[model samples]
Target: MTTSKTEGKQCNLVNHDEIWKVHINMELESAKSWPQKWGFLTESYNQAMQESSKVTDRILKLELPEHLRTRPPTPPEEYLETTQAFIGWRSAVPGLQLERYGRVQCGKKSFLKELGWALDGCS
Candidate 1:
C-alpha cells in the first residue's frame, strides 16, 4: 500500500511539473508576441547600455596610436533614427520606465508583479 501511495505521489509530481512547463511556455509566447508590452525592450536597452559602458571602458583603457585614435568609429545614422523611433514609442506608451540607476520603475504593485514574473518561482 505504501509503495502504491509513493508511486501515486510521484505521478502527481510529474503531472505538476508538466503543467508548470506548459504554463511557462504560454507565458513566454505571450511575452514574445508583445515584448514592449511586457517590458522586454526596456530591459534589453538597459542591458545594451551596460554592455556599451563596458566597451567604452575597454576602449578608454586601450593605449591606441595617435592616428588610430584621431578618428573614432561612428555608428550608422540609421542607428540614431531607430533610437528616435523608440523614444517616440516610449513617450506614447505607459509602461516600464528606467530609473537613473537603470532599474525598472512602475507602480509598486506592478513592479512587484513584474519582479515575481521575472523570478518565476525562484527564491
Candidate 2:
C-alpha cells in the first residue's frame, strides 16, 4: 500500500539522520584528542632535542681544557646504572633540579612570582 511505502521511506530517512549525527560526534571526539596528542608529541620532541643538545655540549666541551669539562666520559661497566639513574632523576621542572645541584637557594617559593620571571626571560 502507498501508506506503508511512505512510512518505510520516512523510517529510512530517520535512520540516515541518526547515522550522520553519530558520524559527526565521532569526528568531533577524534578532533578533541588531536591537541592532546600534539602536546605529547611536542613534549617528546623537546626531550629529544634536550638530549641531543647535551651530546652537542659534550662534543664542544671536548675543545676545552680537560680539567674544565664538567662531565667525565662514561666507563662501560656502569653505563646501565648511570643511564637508569639519569633517566629517573628528572621531573617536569628541570631548572629547579639544576639550581638545587648548584646549591643556588631560592629564598622564597612563589609560583606567581616565578611565573612572572619566566615570562620575562626574553627581556
Candidate 3:
C-alpha cells in the first residue's frame, strides 16, 4: 500500500511538472514574437500619424468659405488617440520589462489586452 501511494504521488508530481513546462514554453514563444509585434505596431502608428498630419496640413492650407469651413472633414480622432497611446506604450513596455521576465510591473495579460484594444481601434 505504501509503494502504491509513493507511485501515485510521483505520477502527480510528473504531471504538475509537465504543466509548468508547457506554460513556460508558451511564454517563451510569446516573447520570441514580441519584437515583431512591436515593429508592426510602430509601423501602424507611424502611418496613422502621417495620414493625420496630411489632413491637418490640407485643412490649414485651404481657403474655403467661412460658412462651409465649419463642416470640413476632420482627421480620424481614433487614429490620433491610438498614435498617442502607442507612443506611451512604446516607452512603457520596455521600462516595465514585460517580456524580459515571466512577471513584471504590468501584468502580461493586462498589457496584451490593452494591445488588443489598440489593434482593434486601428482596424
In the range 1-123, model 1's lDDT, one tens digit per residue, is 224657644355677689999999999999787855767678889999999999999998989764333334357773544667656755444342334356566655655476667645556
Cα-based TM-score, every candidate? 0.25, 0.25, 0.25
**For candidate 3, lDDT tens digit of each residue in 9-116?**
435667768999999999999999998777688888999999999999999997985433333334787344466664565546454443665544754465547566
- Model 2 TM-score, all chains together: 0.25
lDDT of 2 by residue, 2-82 (tens): 246576443566776899999999999998999877768888899999999999988976676533334555787866446
Model 3: worst 10 consecutive residues (lDDT sum):
65-74
The lDDT, on a scale of 0 to 1, for candidate 2 is: 0.68
Q: How accurate is candidate 3 locally (lDDT)?
A: 0.67
Q: Comparing 1 and 3 by lDDT, which wins? A: 3
Q: Residue 80: error of model 2 in Å? A: 70
In order, what is each prediction's RMSD in angstroms? Answer: 27.3, 18.9, 28.3
Clashes of each: 0, 0, 0
